[model samples]
Target chain A: MDSARDEPVLDVRGLRVEYRGDGRSVVGADDVSFSIGAGEVFGLAGESGCGKSTIANAVMRLLKPPAEITAGSIRFQGRDVLALDGRELRAFRWREIAMVFQSAMNSLNPVLTIGEQIGDIFTTHEKLKKRAARERAGELLELVGIDPGRLKAYPHQLSGGMRQRVVIAMAVALRPRLLIMDEPTTALDVVVQQEIMAQIRDLQRELGFSILFITHDMSLMVELSDRMGVMYGGRIVELANAKDLFAKPLHPYTEALMNAFPPLTGPRRELTGLFDAPRTADSCGFHVRCPDDRSDCSANIPDLREVAPGRWVAQSAQGAP
Target chain B: MTHPLLSVRGLTKDFQVGTVFSRRRVRAVDDVSFDLPAGRITALVGESGSGKSTIARCLARLEQPSAGQVLLDGEDVLRTERRRASQVYRRKVQMVFQDPFGSLNPVHRIEHFLARALVVHGHPATGEALRELMTTVGLTEDMLQSYPHELSGGQRQRVAIARALAVRPRLILADEPTSMLDVSVRVGVLNLMRRLREERDIAMLYITHDLGSARYLADTTMVMFAGELVEGGDALAVMDAPAHPYTRLLLSAVPDPERAGSYDPVERARLREAILNPTSCPYGDDGTCSRTEPVRHIVGEDDGQPHWVRCHLRAPASDIARRVLKATDDTEKAETTAA
Candidate 1:
């Protein structure tokens, strides 16, 4: 019941990530900016190579070599995440902001037992004793609806759904303010997906944790999130409340994404075109694919601008957002 | 009304799992039967381990059925010779897979895929005719030279559809074709399949777990539960007025953004529990409901647009059970109250 609107739990401004290799640099996240409040589910949606994941990885400061956070600031609870030292970053990582990777099944160590993996988090962060960590891991397992006794079992022993639950349990072990999940249920069945989603919703209500949910499934994003941001070619093109975004998608790319998903209700309509090839540096990312594409669309790159109250769209040359 | 193009009767598949010494027969697909009318799409929907995929594999001859009859033009394909069956079935039926990226070979150009099928099936005999087939599936002449990796998920699936069409197959079995693509691209693929079915007059077996997409493409839909067709009929009818408890539960669980603001956590939990335990219903194992399996029944005498449902509630004899159990009160009340 915590009001995320009071103050943002996590804030990012002019966030830019770039991949540098062989004396060349490729912009992965270009001036990405978004904020998540406590207990809010903020969705980051885009197609592959759209830089949504880059922003997520950058926030956690987990971007590996070749992928560098070139510019912008990430503030977790008003503290500059970029300013944290190695030891401070390690302590800040999962304790304050935990992440669940795309494939939750693969995220867990196959060789180790679920208990040991979760226990390691407590041992490293909380500096708890072996017995204390094991007990805490059991409690975490129980919290996620897994039998505490099953904590001794290996990841492969559990089904895809159960494995995901285990990953979620581990992620929420420290009761992090913000939990980043990148396509968590993409691998599971719909029935299991519904179950997992419900679990997350229930847990969020109980624990009062915010989420940065990332996926290509816009429908799922709309279902689970409080607010959503649409990404296209390394830019946050549009951001709005989940309901408003689905109701009136502002950006052309956002409109295309909404049109793309087959509605669960109503008459069926054919989607006419596929996403266009990524544009060159000089052109707008969505220029070729946009239904409203004009000569100016190809000539200039658009920037995110607030066209309506609490809704932002990538501004076009015609001054329409 | 035209006769069904493909009719499956008493289809069953049993897999031998565990050690050879103590082998156990797992009935992956039970005695399932359905009719696929020409130019109509029939969806085989179920969760994983529900034998939907097993049935699809059996239909495609990728996996041999332990018991069943696949009648193609009223000829039992299982009884035919291996070589003759392969040749006859290949031209009669073609398959499109879920993973568009995996279905096509990364090393091969998109043209090679369609060209090989065209040559083998004896369609598009001339080079000019082959290129035209490609154009029909919305692929340009330039894309023929592009490799699978170079193309997007939607484009790769289009190529798959094009390859299937090259054989001039009357039936297309698309096993979760759009599930792997981005949501934006998924509709485009589904729309393409729908267009192909309409233009070519091809019967399609569209398999998916996503009910939203199922409602979009299928003319008639089958809801599979624990390897059994628990409910099926007109797609809109089955979706809107889902008869089986499982089907209703599945439909209710679908995340509707409109209703997301007012979701009841308790009701969601109840539905989740019901879905997890498949044997909760009395009709699950009882022979009374299983004997006739309750075929399509006309609720009203108007147009005879009868909707089929496999639940015992639709059976006349189960009136006692319905009143005693009062299973559908909530659903029926909701509908009548809404009206």
Candidate 2:
């Protein structure tokens, strides 16, 4: 908690992103703002197309044509991340902040051996010779708990879990200070998912790196994150400690999202449905689906304000303490 | 105890892997058996490559089993149908695949899918019938006019389910139906399946890797591992006190926010290593689990609901140990001769 007061590892403020084509623009993220402290695991959660991934892409400068960061600032280690040019950005990316996308293991080149792929990172970034890079690649594989002997194996030869570990190993080879993992284990089975998450936690602890974890799995999000933000219609509606958000979610949408998970040990309850509507600039983004939305909710867009110490909620009138 | 709507016996499927010159047989589903009663949901839970989906495909007749009996209403359809499955058998058994994006034809509207399903099964594809099918799955009738791409993941899955229901299937085999959908939309689909069982008495075999959803929606649950049924019983009873070591490992691995900061990575690794390895049987000294098929052992029965486990730990009273020892001796002799 004390780290929250210090210089944050990553800070994003007033972030806005849009997908534009054919003379029309659709908001992908609206005024999103959050920060991760040193060694903190800050989780961003929303359904697909709700702008969680958009924000991640925006921060990584991975946005392409038709998708643009309309407004915002991303600061990494007190430096303007968006201001970094070609080489600076490339150097900043894997060396300072690394990103692991959904099904990253499947993205690995099938033609190359695990050692060759991992060695390429060192040879390209650090300008290390082939033999030296290969040695370091084996160590990275060992760090992620895969047998170093399998470094010579191709991606197709490794199991899905082992391939995922290889990706994680490659991502942290440079010991980046912050790691962005988006649904890192969604494609994995429960046992494999647990193993991967445990390995990630251990890696973070050993390397002292912050993580910007993104996923739609609420239970996994709560289990891993120190703080979390709930997104709806491309806007963050709630931000608080992960445990507090799970126990007492102030926003109605967050509460509904929590109830949607089928419990393993409880009486079965009827799950509610989430309504999807185009976002309106004048109203709160979640007003259409919010169960407790009032007239003011549609009349005025509520800003994300501090409703309690270290807790933030975006709602009209009733959000006030 | 009336007869179940669907009963599978000794289901087995094998796939040939490796190059043609060096082919190896991999048993995907081995001697699996289960029953799905009318108006009840039976969940088959397992990890990837654990034969859960293979079982579903066998039931749907999408794959020809190496050897098995698929009895629908006390009739063995495998023996009856020679070449392809009869249209009546296809109508009685329908399948819902995992990926909605892949399952539904993107070029065609939702109406085409449902109407064709009805017409192919000898049912009248009227506008009223289509509307009824849409409403039955809790989707609006207007959605039928839209293509699969226009709908959300959840909506597409519902459309897939609606198409399956349009034929009035006696047993629906859903293989990881909601796994691809978001967490918020997943429950709505599960609720619809539960409603279908209650309203239409449709027996369902829900195949999934998610233990939580199985416990939530299933009346009976069966856990599978490496193509074998490891544990099975009443859903609540099995989930509460899982009998097999594999089931217990799966349950412990499930993500629970309530159990934060209490993850024992070392213990998880040990359990996983012991269960997932193929060469060593964790509970036995002779590698019996790797070599021999597990025999069912009734561990407990409560209120006429029997809980059974198929593990070496539960088969101590049986003569399986002696038989495995004898088999191990013969295998040793054969290996020496081959060498």
Candidate 3:
């Protein structure tokens, strides 16, 4: 781990986001904070509407209207990203921090050739000539394992996996210090997902770039991340090293996620717990469905605290250690 | 033992791929057969273009099979008249799709979906009985008024399940039912299916590309490749022993935290290449696999039931040698094709 004093590649603190709805505000992210070191893969895992994606958008300064970062600080490479003006933010986007969205197939322009889409990145950031940009585009495609000669083909001409590679190629066009990928392989089949993940791992190793990988797949997160943060109901319920988190997940929600996925190698058993009724308004977010819920769970909202070395957990009705 | 609930024999489907005058035929689903035993889940596992979905579609009669028989309770439905087949088959087998959102109509309320199935299959004579079925699937009476878009993914899936149950079908064909759901919510849907199987004895054919879920849900698992069942038997045995090379490759590719640092990219590539190779084995003039084809070898006895595998490695020495030579030639062809 990098020292606390050293400048981190991406630092976020006291971050809170809200979605205004029907004269009331819905809490998307409440007091979330974390930092990523250089060449680190930070995983954010949660069920749908957990606000992990909202936090990523907040960091990127990409949140749409009505969904706003109500409070927080986002610093990229020691610069205040939230404080940047519109022109500065535009310049900072691809040059300093790039994004690879979930639907890479749709993210690329269908009409444009793969080379032109990638070339746009260099032209926009470096103000390169058309010929120079085309040359650089070929090099980027080659880096991602696509043949340079095939760059003239349109997006639809390539397979889903190849289009994802093209999106990755474009994201790293400027060699950004940080890359954020949202559910990058959720749409892919298992074999194709494995291939894409392997490519991502190799690129991270070679480029030494920091990544903020957001996905709901717990097993994938454990395999690829250095550190993992578990989110629930828009709160960071648990954060720890990948191995430690899987081995001994402190939060109730984290433990539930571990139990949900069947063991990859094991005897067959009829696994259950698929239909959990939603929690009542007064109860804790997990209380209604939690196997170990107590009466006190309905009344208190748990705060995340450091329970052990580099491990954090939410306070439960059973009380903190 | 009693006869299987659903028995398929020599199922085949072919598609015309190229231009009009010069036609090119693609054998999308070759001669394939399997059984869904009474009160048990069977998974048809494979990657894309492996004819897994085509098999499912044929079983559902969504696409007309070019040949072979789909026997529901010993009656050859494909041979039956089209109109009568729809009536009988619709009541016996219902399909749950991969996308929960797309399965339900966007404009209609949740109750309308369930009501339509119930009325079609002749159920819920009164409003009270209709609401009772809604509660049976864990949805409150209030949710009946909400549109499909208003519900969460998990809720929408439950509605889909409830719609299937409303028909009170003998068999349920769930095609990647929980693949689109959240990780936490996926278990909920799987558990619901298990409960239905136990309480109602609804035989399920759970088709999925995810082996982890297949291992969890299936009683008997069939591994499909290029429109053929390469390996099958008890789910536990197939997953644990995994006799075929393709089955082993699938198992190894699953993301496990325990084996994080042990994966080799080159090995994965080799396995992928092996799966993609066409003409790995020769079929006879009648389109049946040849006498030299890999035989189904019983690996071991698991809980008194025999575990089976279909691979050249498990076959006799002569077949193995033939397959080895064929594999070598295919590698050369693959290299030239890539070049």
Pick the DockQ winner.
2
DockQ of each: 0.51, 0.60, 0.58
lDDT of each: 0.80, 0.85, 0.79
Candidate 1, residues A85-176, lDDT tens digits: the string is: 99898889888999999887787889999989999989988999999999999999888888999988999889898999999988998989
Residue range B149-256, candidate 1, lDDT tens digits: 888888888889988988999999998888787665676788788888888899999999988788888888888877778777777777877777678767766667
Clashing pairs in 2: none
Docking class of 1: medium
lDDT winner between 1 and 2, please give it.
2
Task: Report the lDDT of model 1 for residue B23.
Answer: 92
Candidate 1 TM-score for chain A: 0.94
Interface root mean square deviation for model 1, in Å?
A: 2.6
Candidate 2 stretches greater than 4 Å from native:
A1-5, A21-23, A281-294, A316-321, B261-294, B312-339
Q: By descending TM-score, how would the candidates be arranged? A: 2, 3, 1
